[model samples]
Target: MVGQAQAVAAPRHHEQSHLRGLVEVAGASVLWGTGGLALQLIREHEPMSPITISAWRMATAAVVLLLALLALRRGPELVHLARTRPRQLLVVGVGTAAYQGFYFVSVTQVGVAVSTVVSLGLAPVLLTVVESVRQRRAPTPGRLAVLATALLGLVLVSVAGHASSTGPDPVLGVVLAVASGTTYALTALAGGSISRETSPLVLTSGMTLVGAAVLLPLLAVVDGPRVSADPVALAWLAYLGVLTMALAYVLLYSGLRVVAPSTAVTASLVEPVTAAVVAAVVLSESLGPAAVAGIVLVLLAVAGLGRPSAAAGPVLPDPGR
Candidate 1:
């Protein structure tokens, strides 16, 4: 009787832990979703180039994260990660820097709602394909179906959000946005794989440090040492650096302990949704009927991906055949 009781309690505890983790990941998504909206807000008052904004954001985040690591006495662990996982750390750092740079540039050129929806909406599908290739197995039917649904939804969203105003060439913005997505997917996978063996804070701090180092020259050339001319712009930059990039990553890493990587990615779909809604509400941007439909489809696709697949057995890789 005691054995059965302990077994039942174990699962209940795990379920609760999982719920807590999901909440953390959802919170991270909410912060991430605010990125574009925040940028739009800053751009309204002070006109800054996207590259400049990205560089400052990364550099600031790196400083804040490094400070936190020092405060927590994790500096040694970061050095150890550098020695053992240098290649992986560099890959993640470069990917992180590139994703932020390209994503900001794409949104500035193509508008926040459209660029964000497209880039984030496509990340999971791409990640799934990458995971399958890495595992040396064919994707199962369930994954295929989810990918199809996600693609269809993406098409609907793209068509709905089409603009006639001829902003920066849509083709260029789209190509960069897709590249950003690829970098984001790679970073997530690499982070997850590395975090399995190391402390999340250490990994995050090191990556941010490396990314910041890479962006310093670009920031100097593009912005010429002007971090921000206006107080509001400075505030937004600080928020992005401290809350969204630094703290949010720490929360995300913590949440991953209880959530599967696939589920965490699916949950992050909330970010784009929040960004679009904020744009519509605060900026008074019109999404049009097709955009409404696309949003619905994207949300549904997210839901479907969140559901457990029978073939995969709750997080198991599907059989190759």
Candidate 2:
């Protein structure tokens, strides 16, 4: 009876844990959705360049996360990570800065909705392909269908958003967005490998610290350092750093620790949807019928990925842990 009760409780616990991870990733995506708007708004008040914003975002997040670790008495753990896993930290850190820097530059060339959709929408597709290659098998039909639906949705959103965009250079923006997505996929794959064995807080703190170290130097090469004195711009910068970079990434690493990288990226499909709606409402960026349909399709793809299916193969425990 005792063994049977334990068996029954175990699956239930796993289900609940997975549900929590999904929620955490979803929350992170929502927070990230607001980032483009924040960056745009920040620039409206200050002439700080994209690299400047990216650098400050990383620096601020690093400071906040490191402080949190100290408060939690986990500062030594962060040091241990730095001492033991410097390579992983550097890969994820540099990758994080590169993707974000690419994304913010894309936002400048393209409108927020288009940039967000193209950059974020491309990641899951890349990750899916990588996973299929890693497994040495073709993606199951169900997974293929879901990927196709997502790709179709991403196309609709991109085309519709671009058609109505007033940005200076849509083509250039798209190229940068693609670069961002590629870097994002690589970072997720690297980070996912270690997240399960490391505390999310410690990992995030280390990554942000390393990211800041990488970006701060680039600030000088790009445009020299520019500080914004405007209170409003400062507030937006704070929000971008704290809510989007620090907190959102903590949630993301937490989810990555539990879910497959492909599933985690698919869940983040929510980011573009959230960005589109916010841009339409706040920035007066209009979304046409096709874009709305795309949003619905993306949501459906996310849902489909979350549901367990036979074609997805047997649930294998993460070897990383």
Best by lDDT: 2
1-321 per-residue lDDT for model 2 (tens digits):
999998997766665566567678889999988987898899889878888988899899999998898888999998888888889989999999999888878877887667767787788878877878878988788877877787677667666766655479989998999999999999998888878779889999999988999898886677634787899999999998999999999999988776777778877877777777888999898889998998898778877766555112223343343
**Candidate 1 — which residues are off by over 4 angstroms?**
1-22, 107-118, 134-171, 223-225, 257-262, 304-306, 310-321
- In model 2, the Cα lDDT at residue 50 comes to 82
TM-score per model over all chains: 0.80, 0.88
Which run of 10 residues does model 1 get worst, by summed lDDT?
312-321
Q: Which residue pairs clash within candidate 1?
A: none
Task: For model 2, state the Cα shift of residue 54 in Å.
Answer: 1.2
Query: What's the CA error at residue 286 for candidate 1, in Å?
Result: 3.8
Candidate 2 stretches with Cα past 4 Å from truth are 1-12, 106-118, 164-175, 310-321
Candidate 1: Cα lDDT at 240: 86
What lDDT does candidate 1 reach at residue 192?
66
lDDT of 1 by residue, 54-137 (tens): 667777888988888889888899999999999999998888898878877786577654666567766776767666776788
